[model samples]
Target: MRLSRSLAFAALFLLSLTTASVAGPGRITLPAEVTATGQVIRLGDIAVLEGPATAALGDLTLGPAPAAGESRTLEGARVLDALRRAGADLAAITYTIPPVIRVRRASQEVSEAAVRQILEGFLAEALGAGAADAELKSVELPGPIRIPAGPYTARVVPPADRPLLGRVRLGLEFTVEDRPVKSVWVTADIGVYGPVVVATRAVARGDTLAAADLTTERRDLSQTGRSVLTDTVDAAGRIARAPLVPYTPVRRDQLVLPADIHRGDVVLLVAERGRLRITAPGEAREDGTRGQQVHVLNRLSRKDLVGHVVDGSTVAVDF
Candidate 1:
């Protein structure tokens, strides 16, 4: 009698599990659904899509990590449009595959259905409902999932579960390998990027000019000259003190003389064959001999330096 009762209970448990499709720890719904015509795209958390990933994007790149409330996903416009724009050309890509990062929350607090939606939004791998022909294990979740979510990571869950619904923000940073890639989805993002001024010159190897890297049209260098066209990096874009450009890719910064420089005014000077020069403050006697020293200034660098006069303000020093 005990054995027969046990068997009956086992069958009941199995039936219950089948009824509650999205069940247990991660509550993953087996056989993820996909559409017949459309496929899904999963984006990474805050990321920068660059390297050879560019070329086609020109100056445009993705942000640090993919975001949740961003306009690109559900609308299917921003990222999808770019990839669709690329078509089949290997050089052209409109989408980027993100590393699947999973998220989990407390179970009773979240429901089965809610968990599924978050997973769908987070993974976004399956294609549209087909003749239900193809199946791909595109999404990877945290392994050996337990029952009842509690800080679960990289796992999928039911759709209705709310408190248990968490996000695994994916970040799509890729290093391309020289494989014979058939279909490529290059990472592309459409939104605000930089005025993210990066230094194109290094301080070493004779390219230490910060003035050219950062542009500022003070007083009279504007097209209309009404307001100074100050194109300087605001805090975030500015590189602090140290140089950050690699040697092979550096474009040297130039030292241009201000057209309106006045005599007896303190100025910066740079000579092809000598130390940077700066003029001394306060005027000397009308006699050319009175405290006569040639003060050359390096206008590119806003530093004050003095040098011995070769003749008047023309000074010589080795670079």
Candidate 2:
């Protein structure tokens, strides 16, 4: 029975030694070159980890990652020191590391064409309803942008308190994983087109505008003033206040409503006081359209008075 007990104790001791040897000191093997996508480099990112304690040591942060499209070199001695500082058990780890390791941040190039497409989408949303006829004449980017390799989003910011028309600068912001990584400005030329009334033929002053004399055309509204006429019907039958050149946009200030009453014309002057009406002969002293007040010579009273033009031949005067 004593020999049997001794033999059992020896078996237990041998089993324990084998198990300890199998689970001993983790292995850390640094590669010659590594590509990192994250902003910070971790021990597991640049090195191949092995053994039981690797799970605890893999989370140790070494340092910041290289910039996008950039590379950094780290010495093996420095890496070991960093691991030690981060509470990694160096005594319980074995290393198969190179003297120096090259770490590059993986990146992608954003082409100019892609950037323009992004800007176009943003401009369309920014212009709202007016975007239907809006166009991007040209887009000038600073240059190609390099971003970290991952899913990313781009945001375009338009100039504040400024019209979207004409030359303007737009801001571009690039974000990777919800973190802003780069900012840049791009110049753009924008144009908004709309139909406008233009003189098809030269129109002399005081000549009534006809449909044959005017036509509607698509033009860049930004170059034209806001008061430009859009419909030929609005300008037709209206007298030209100034000579209009051919192919020029018709403005509101260039046309006037045809006069209903002209100067030196004989008209009926009417005076009303609470439905007590009186009519007398009068002469218009000036030309006036409907709803316009004009000077009238009252023949019976032999006096000049201001009266509202009611029609071609009738003028209403206050008693």
Judged by TM-score, which candidate is best?
A: 2
Clashes of 2: 0
C-alpha lDDT of residue 201 in model 1 = 46
Q: How many backbone clashes does candidate 1 have?
A: 60
Candidate 1: stretches off by over 4 Å: 1-139, 144-195, 204-211, 214-232, 235-240, 246-319
Q: Against the hidden reference, what TM-scores do the models get?
A: 0.16, 0.64
Worst window of 10 by summed lDDT in candidate 2: 18-27
For candidate 1, what is the lDDT? Answer: 0.31
User: Highest lDDT among the candidates is held by which one?
Assistant: 2
lDDT comparing candidate 2 with the true structure: 0.88
Tell me the tens digit of each residue's lDDT in model 1 across 1-319. 9999999999999999866543321121111121111012323212223334333443222222222112222232444344446442324322333333222211223333433344444334432342132222133332322222223233332234321112222222211122111111211111111122334444433333455554322121111221222344232222233344422221113222122323554432324524544343332112122234433445544344444433343433234
Candidate 2, residue 85: Cα displacement in angstroms equals 2.5
